[model samples]
Target: MARDTGPGLARGSTARGRGATRSPGWALAVILTLICVVAGLVPGRPGTVALAVPFALLALSGRDHRTGARSGTEPLVLISTDRHLTRSTSTLRLLLTPRPKEEPTKTLAAPSLVAITLAAPGCPADGLVLQADEECPLVADIPVSGEIAVLSYGSAGVSADVVRPTDFVQAPPVRVSVLPQVGPTLARPVSRRLSGLSGSHTSRRPGEGGELRSIAPMQPGDQQRRIDWRATARRSTDQDMLMVRRTFADAEASVVLVVDRANDLPASTEDWFAAGTSTLGQGSLHVARTAAATVAASYLAAGDRVGLDDLSGTRRPLRSAAGSRQLEQIRTRLAGMSVVPRRRHRRDPVPPQGAVVIIFSAFLDEEPARLLRLWHAQGHPVIGVDCVPVLQRTESSRAQDQTVRLTLLRRRLLLEDLQTEGITVLSGSVQDEPGRQSEREHGAPLPDAAGTDLDTGLRLLARQSRRGAGLSAAPGTARGIR
Candidate 1:
């Protein structure tokens, strides 16, 4: 987070009537000149010099007036220790006032304010949590102080005590919410199916054998000794009864969602073609967030662990695990991720084994392909979600030619390549329905195949019991499992 700390003047030239007014001194000079001419004191060199004196003074006054007007309108920024300023010492303050208001006895409060506070080393950093008193206008300060930053929402009064001469770090507040439509699908299984599996069996009786039901007559191959003699004698018929064994698929699975944040796409039509065909959405980080959230929620509801690996900055991978608590941790990590440029690493770290590797990235280059290959080779199910349509068409260009065709072609190539490498590829535009392209592409028969590869792909996906598998593997092309 970077704060703007330079001079506060608005850029570009000011329009007429929008700038400082003419100085009062100029008016006074005109009045004095009138008086001098009317008095007729020699009306020669002395009169000329006398008139010039007032004009000279007016010119200086005009300059000062302009300077004062500019300064007075500037914002007065204050970084406070707390919202109420009850305690705490570390603070900074800067005052800016408009030139026109310099002469007036007026107090200026900033219409908008931004503040950032950094925690001292070893202090417990809580991150950017905002709290405000009932009387306060806006309480946008984040309490986590490792390198805390805050900005006023829209145009709001800002006051704080932490203004230093140096620049301060600022970060946007973390926003977390279940995607309304997909949330229920991700959450239902966790609370219902998983909970039932963990609970004790419901068939137990109240008293006998510590709530265990009475055993009936033994059948062939049944263990003979444990059969309740009294119950079997009463029945007078052959039967077999034993404790039912419950299977819990509620065991959690861990998934590592790898997102590539590197911006390496070209700037021309070729670049657009390249992006249009990739699995990840044109390598845009925002698309990555959406896809990651969707996948993370799905696995989380299944009682499967989820972790994040930001392919930006340092590749300090967030490990995966499932539980209500671990899910919260994953959400927090995802919320805090910031998109950054790619780093240069001659040697990339190997992805961890046994975890489902769901990579959300635009497969613009060979790097992501290599990573997916490595994960698949290690016996982990690797699913690559392609996010196409990085650019939005305007109303005027709604009927643009060739753009849509080229986009589809590139996407198809990308998906085919990935499929050949054994990585499951899913592709689709963010604005369209989720599974349309996957169904279409997977439904079509492969060239020279006896039946459609689409059917075989569906069977493979059905066997896995997870949606969004078995599609052509290429960059920038098709929409797969969402």
Candidate 2:
């Protein structure tokens, strides 16, 4: 299959094979001839013999168009996707140019129309017979798989040649982003876990013009208007000690989504075709992407800087940014990952200091455990989003079932441990129901982790993480984050 880069255009030849393209005119002639023959067999129908001769002659007239194409050289096909804003579904037009007509051996040839149907690797659209000048609209379900749409074609129509040969055409695969099932807008803005220079997250830093942090003794640089006269006078005695007001600095945080694609996508029951069924099965890639996109959009909407890191190599590494374009880029990149990546574990990147990283994975492997643990040890708040399979399923025997049970037990324990370390872990299934975290999972209580609706709690956690009791900070010290 060939790949074309720009959005919505796929051009390529079919999978290699020599097949016949036959004209329908001969089939019509055969039917007429059979009718004539039947009439002649009946009593007092001698004129039917004359009619049968003409019908037989007509059957042998049209030349099939199958002469030019040879083995491994299927006909060229053009597939273009068009979006109609008013219509909910998009349309894909397949423009087929049949092999040019050869020397006409038979007179009164069939129409130049060629019938095309999907052959190996079934297509999203039903079969269509189209003229060289005309394009047919496919009954395609758009965005069938991530960004790449898979389709194959074969000749059902006869070429304008003697013997009326046929050719099966497997068109090239294309990348397309049509309708995506983006989840509902978050009920609340995502909460960030770190104190940073600037963002929508209210910071732990003490500064001017924000929610009151506390009141303290008036210092030399303290503004005169900041004096809390009521508190100062109440605390005042024979001595002249003064009091002033303090407030927190409004700041923002950075969020990075680490999407894990390094595993065999569990076979999707939905996209996977079964015996006598056409509904396609979708898999873990869809699940992972849905969770990742949702996480990115939520955090970006909360005014936190968001970046993407994919283990699957389907996307380039994106720097953290809070912009509409960033969201679009992320979505587009995610939608285009049509192929499921092979499982390959590698070293995880060390997240930048104070960045809250969300790891989206199935959590079936131990690599995520090690990676998340490393992030935690570095003091970066890590949230684990377990991307449970949506369309993909793995076959299992009794031993596999026991193994799965053991793995789940281990997974639950690992997540519980992560929570104990202050890393937030959530299930992809319950993503929309944020309240599920409040409940115990396999007897583990979540730390009210990041992205919780409780911003104040996260703010307090950020303050704790940044306050006087950290690795770089001394027992008593004053510092400012730029």
Candidate 3:
């Protein structure tokens, strides 16, 4: 930004800076020179001083013809950053642009020394430096780590910027936007129909995949090239008959993350922040995002297209996209995701045909379960991942607590309804802390999440889905950010 210092000259303050300082000696000398001239000009002036007094005093003054003819006292230094904002550890290029010098003039400053100092948060003393006669366009790496990395420059013994110079400025602070980073994922994938692409899944009805399915007697319409002579010879019963080989077709599958943002019992922002050090017990939104990203990463890494949508429908849905670049875009979008309040205008988007839709949710009600049924009815393979962490009873009367128990029982019954509709409720090993685990004694009792860890739950689902049947609705696990 440009700050108007005076007429014609403007000071560029990138972020923040203080006013300039002027030396007292220069002002005192100029005043004395004026006094000396006035005294000599008087007709009845003291006979002690004649015409020689005025010119002699002026010569001794700080202001000189050489200095006045110049624009400034010395070459003004301009400090600036390459970018106004950046993230952690990102390379920062600071440009120290000094006004061109015609010839070095003798000032109180020592030309042999060019002192450089920097003031910034999370910054060490060694940010950037310039030699006595260093050239321009120099590269300096600033080591930074924090939410905001401030930057300021200082030039010791340089009188040019001391007296309200307009050329000097402090660069703006760098804002670090550190989002959650997702790591490698573990997901067992399956695709029913094999198409043109070669992939891991074996298609049910196939023409050309390398994985062998079965060998059969050749019919009249069978291709002669597909004949398996060895199979015919091995089986005496079929020795006289021509045997043909059948193989599963290779095909790529698409996955859609059907994130359920309609959780009635989500962790409060205060509760989420209160357990700052707890790795497993973050907010529900965080768990949902992580689960969605995990599934996306697994499928994408397997060379499959992935898409994302919100049950709340507050934001525009992302269509199915392929390739490595899409992963970064997906991660960034997930990081900016917020817990949107339920809206009546929410519309249910349809998943692609033959695509696998993984729903991340906490089944507080039957609505999310009913949504799964719709996807299943449309011939899409659906998997439900319950992102609910272990629940703790709130303060209430016995009658109110009984109502909570009935609500939970109804929720469990709805889960069974999902299974009857062919959805696998993935029961994961989720629990409150050892101390909080016993809180269930004060509240409604719940079935133990059957598994050693969260991975065990996911692994169970992966195994169950291997048969290509409907699967998923597992309890939440503590799979850390990655």
lDDT of all predictions, in order shown?
Answer: 0.42, 0.56, 0.54
In terms of TM-score, how similar is model 1 to the real structure? 0.45
Q: CA shift at 274, candidate 3, in angstroms?
A: 11
Pick the winner on lDDT between candidates 1 and 3. Answer: 3
Q: Write the per-residue lDDT of candidate 2 for residues 256-353, one digit (tens) a residue.
A: 87877664244332222233332133445666677677667766776667888876654557888887788887887776654446345455576656
Model 1, span 61-91: residue lDDT tens: 3332322233322322323323333322223
Stretches > 4 Å off in candidate 1: 1-75, 78-250, 264-283, 313-315, 390-411, 433-482
User: For candidate 3, lDDT tens digit of each residue in 308-392?
Assistant: 8877788887888777777776776776665566566545677777777777776766667877888878777677776655555
User: TM-score-based ranking, best first?
Assistant: 2, 3, 1
The estimated TM-scores of all candidates read 0.45, 0.61, 0.51
lDDT of 3 at 314: 81
Which residue pairs of candidate 3 clash? 426-473, 426-474
Regions of candidate 3 where Cα sits further than 4 Å from its true position: 1-184, 189-196, 216-229, 232-244, 262-281, 345-347, 391-422, 427-436, 440-454, 465-482
Q: Model 2 Cα displacement at 394 (Å)?
A: 10
- What TM-score does candidate 3 reach? 0.51
TM-score of 2: 0.61
Candidate 1 global CA lDDT score: 0.42
Name the candidate, 1 or 3, with the larger TM-score value.
3
